[model samples]
Target: MRILVTNDDGIFAEGIYDLAKALQDIGEVIVAAPNSERSATGHAITIHHPLRVDKVRFFDTTIEAYSISGTPADCVKLAVEALLKDRRPDIVISGINNGPNLGTDVIYSGTVSAAVEAAIMDIDSIAISMGSTNITQYTDAANFVCRIAKEIIHNNDIKDTIININYPTCPKEEVKGVKVTTLGVRKYENTFIERKDPRGNSYYWTSGNVVDMEQNQDSDILALQNGYISITPIHFDLTHFKTFEKIKKLNFQK
Candidate 1:
């Protein structure tokens, strides 16, 4: 089996590197990721500027890697369309992201976007994230992802959905179990922070704190809060099913 591994955390991130190493024993691993961190970039693609891909050495692994001047989605697009045109990978796995992609956070995550892009291309894909800012060790997350990837590659039923997994920031033994969940709501305290440059020009920075929600046992947030790995099946479709019938009932000009 051949696996295409990518992430929003750049090619040299510890998370990506660890994940690649772990999967190497299972299959041929290929790393195609951003040259720099592109966290929270969503599904944006590069349109105007010409994209450049450079091959560089990352740690001990002499893997063929690329650094593209684009978003995470663009990296996956360019990889399949241009880089790996001759051989299509069996699956695409994005991230062991620096932080968890729970609740509405997935909407803005480039880590998840890369996986979504792969799924749009009709390949099985998954986005893996660790629910912590301080990521000292990634082995546990990598192993967990490897186990899921193996199951996904073999099972036809699991291939029908795109997976977004979030691991809590605790010892593997402390993890209760895995929970299949839905996206949760994340209210924010603030969206932006105003700052002044040394030249006195004012600029805004995006920063916010996660808002607590009332206990909803089925949500990703709640699952993570309770020390369980959250696996939320995500899709590219943005149709609001609840509002669809209501909108259909409204009469409009023919």
Candidate 2:
């Protein structure tokens, strides 16, 4: 199997590095990631600015890698459309992200968007994230990824959609188990601190604190908090079928 790896955490991030190494045991892994961090940059593509891709070696062994001057989604796009045009990857895995992409957070996550981009291209995709900001939990996350990826690939029937996995911030043994979950609601109270620059001009720094929202026990958020890995199958289709049917019942004469 051929695997394409990308992330929003930058090409040299510890999470991505560990993830690439783990994935290598399963298939030929090629990484094409952003040169710098592009967190929360949802499914953005580079159209105005020219996209640049450079081949470089960051690991001790020789591995095909590219530093891209684009968003996480752009990495996958460029790799499929240009870099590996003839030999496209069988699967695209994004992240091993620095932090969790849970609930509604996935909407704004570049990590998840990278996988979404691959799914749009009809390729099997997975987004891997760790609940903690610390890099120490990455090994456990990578192991979980290996297990899940193998299950999905070998099973065959599971490759048609995108899968999001968020590992809890706990020891491997401490993790109770894995749960297939649904996306939950997550709210945040945002704050803006106004400050003065060297020239005395006003500048505002954006910050926010996550406010715990009411969620079901079966939700991804609760699963992670309970020391369980959460796997949520997601898609780009936003059609509200119920609403469509409701509106269709209203008869409006032309």
Candidate 3:
């Protein structure tokens, strides 16, 4: 099996390294990611400027990796379209992201965007994240992906759905189990601090406090809060089928 690994965090991030290293035993792992961090850069592709790629030494050349000047979506697009064009990978795994991408956070997540890109190309993908920012280990997350990837590759039932997973920061032993869940609501108390630069130029720095707004018992957010790994299968179709007729009722002309 061949796998394409990527992340929104720059290639140097510990999460991606641990993930790629762990998956090496499973298959040929290719790492193509942004040279610098591109966190929260959703579904964006760089088209105006010519992309630059550098063949960097990662893991002593045992695995092929490249640092590209683009977002997470760009990395996956370039890898499949150009870098590995001759032999496309069977699956694309977009993270062991530095932080959890749950509920509405996936909308702005570069990590999830990479997986979405793969799904667009009709390839199975998984976006795995760790729920805690204070943790250092990613082995459990990596191992979990390996196990799930085997099921996805051989099982056609899981096709066309992008798997979104979030493992809590607690130790592996503390994890209760996996929960198949729905997208939950996550909000933030957004704040922007106004400050003056050394040259007296005023600018605003972005910051926010995350708020768990999920009240549903079967939501991914609630599952993570209860010490369980949350796995939410998502599809790209944005049609609100439930409200399709509601909007159609406001019919204008034929």
The candidate scoring highest on TM-score is: 3
| Per-candidate RMSD, Å | 1.6, 1.5, 1.4
- On lDDT, who's better, 1 or 2? 2
lDDT of 3 by residue, 75-163 (tens): 99999999999979999999889889999889999999999999999899999999979786999999999999888989888888899
Model 2: lowest-lDDT 10 consecutive positions: 152-161
The C-alpha lDDT values of all candidates are 0.89, 0.91, 0.92
Ranking of candidates on lDDT, top first: 3, 2, 1
**Which residue pairs in candidate 2 collide?**
none
Clashes of 3: 0
Give one digit per residue, the lDDT tens place, for model 2 in 48-86. 989988998967756799999999999999999999999
Q: Write the per-residue lDDT of candidate 1 for residues 1-254, one digit (tens) a residue.
A: 78999999898899999999999878888888998999989998999989989877767987777778888999889999888898888899998899989888888899999999998998899999998787668999899899999999888876546799999889888999999999998777878788999999999988787777785779999998899999999998889999999999998977
Model 2 alpha-carbon drift over 4 Å, by segment: 198-200, 251-254
CA deviation > 4 Å runs, candidate 1: 197-200
- State residue 49's C-alpha deviation in candidate 1, in Å: 0.3
